[model samples]
Target: MDTVKPKDRDFIQTVDDHLFCVVGYLHPPDGYTAYLKYVPSPDGKWGKDGRRYSRTLPFYHVSQVENTYRYLKEKYPQYLFDCPVRNITISWVPKSHVKQYYHPREKLGEIMSRGANDFLERKLLDLSTVLEDKAGIKNRIGVTGSILTETHNPSFSDIDLTVHEDNASRKLIEALRELKEEADLVKPVTPEEKEGWVKNRAERFPLSVDDLRNIAEKRWNYGYFEGTYFSVHPTRTDEEITEDYGDNTYHRKKVVEGTTTVSDNRDSIYLPAVYGVEDSDEVSEVVSFEGLYGSLFEVGDRIRFKGVLEEIRGKDPHYRVLVGGAGSPNGYIKWV
Candidate 1:
């Protein structure tokens, strides 16, 4: 279908999903079982030799295998041939499964609140999972946004964080990833549709990040039309996230540490980060590598060691750890 549009192509990732698939029909040679599809190169399709080099032959992910016949009837309606064209199919994987974009037509504050509410609604399922699976959980994860919906318009890259649990685990992360694909996201303040209340939206609703992002995209405040979306919470703030996702048991007692990695691009080097500091009678949550860009730091050099928990990039593919140093703070302190 040539579904790859410029905006939808670059940021659009064919997320690996176990749920649904999209089968494609391509122009193939007669009697040929399969043909090598050529994806254009970054440079250009036609080279000096008028030949194309390597291309990523993407795999298709289809759904509802039981309704293959029905699917064929819908897609290939005119062709009433009894047998399905076996080799005539070319597959395109699903890319729009995340969430549909939204178009806002109201005040900016209204849009921001709507966006926040939509984000919260989407995490309801995960929150339910956390509530059901965890043991001996004491603290509650608070859900809120960085730009508190009080302004006329919310800024770009604003965040909505849901903190229903105190700690996040690897197992929990996998579960969350699964939850994202299990269903598409929904947005309130939808035009002409019956609106859902805030309570009903947040508790029972579970949405994909894209769903909330659609809200942002439609609004004018943020770089909405730019088509970028990311949500960072209080914990994800400089302090909390620097530490590993609660996998720092080795350094928990002696020296505390925290670390995070890029989602992909394993070689992508980010600024070093250090979290946890003891300021006399107080504590600093996190200190980051970018925080030390100029002052007492030089280019091509690692972040200098500071308070007890210094965030260090580790050797393992996704391993980053922090260890205790001299006079580390008590780790926890009540905010005044």
Candidate 2:
């Protein structure tokens, strides 16, 4: 069997049946830096192919990731890795331990080939087709989340689409924004829905409801399709990934708070959302790994941010403020 390299938003099933979702694009040669998502258990709520699995990580929060790290440290130490470049201990699945590799693009093609078997599958096809026709996005979209794993509940499982290629992803969001205005089927989240989302997110983030609302308003990736909740994740293609693994080293400095104007936000849609700042003596970029902060800002938007300052040592040395995932609990970027 050929070795498969998992990219961001992809999932990996270990030989021992543990499920992990790949993190960033760059990874160690020996293994992938992923986080545990599900584990097999008789009492699990999710079942597929006669096997039941329980979710270990309920939410994508820094605290939850830490809890997962502790759980793995106690029981599955083999999956833990002491990363040298990042200088942090994180969950890593060795290449030799992988039994199955799941790619979002491939799974999407398989589904599109077989045709829909249920209402959710039908909706998935309709949604993808609409995006392709209306947004000029073709063969660049994929399905993720529970649907990708074949454990989706047709009655309630939310649609999670991965839009590959940076340009297509950007175009998809732009089209969705316009579609909401012109089409009846595509609509922005209702106030009641926003309230529910705010309440759910308030437990994880430290921001106030008003702050959350402000951030949510700018999130073009999230909304509704045919009255069904859905979110579009922008993923970079292989060619779009400029930096390779071990290209640079990062050292976490001290936490810093400041206000800066956003100079560019083209790459802000991806995970580890990168934002170019204008006229900053200490830092030039603000990178965030939290999903809530993705696509949360625009060019020329002045924002206040609190995060860990990181020194990047490579051919071009510079400083950047890192938000989310071990940065700091209070780390955030908001309108200034």
Can you write out model 1's per-residue Cα lDDT over 1-336, one digit (the tens) per residue?
233211101111112211111111111221111112222244533221243322222221111222233543565322222222211133323323322211111122243345434443334334433423542232323323222212112223233323321244223333333433342331222332212322332332233333333333232111111122322121222232233222222122234433222122211112222332333222233332221110121222222222243232232122222212112332211111
Q: Clashes per prediction?
A: 18, 0
Assess each prediction's global lDDT (C-alpha) against the native. 0.25, 0.83
Candidate 2 clashes between residue pairs 3 or more apart in a chain or in different chains:
none
TM per candidate: 0.21, 0.94
- Model 2: how far is 226 from its true place, Å? 3.8
Best by TM-score: 2
Model 1 per-residue lDDT at 20: 18
Number of backbone clashes in candidate 1: 18
Q: Kindly provide the TM-score of model 2 when superposed on the true structure, using C-alpha atoms.
A: 0.94
Worst 10 residues of 1 by lDDT: 5-14
Runs in model 1 lying further than 4 Å from the true structure = 1-139, 144-149, 152-158, 162-172, 181-183, 186-230, 234-336
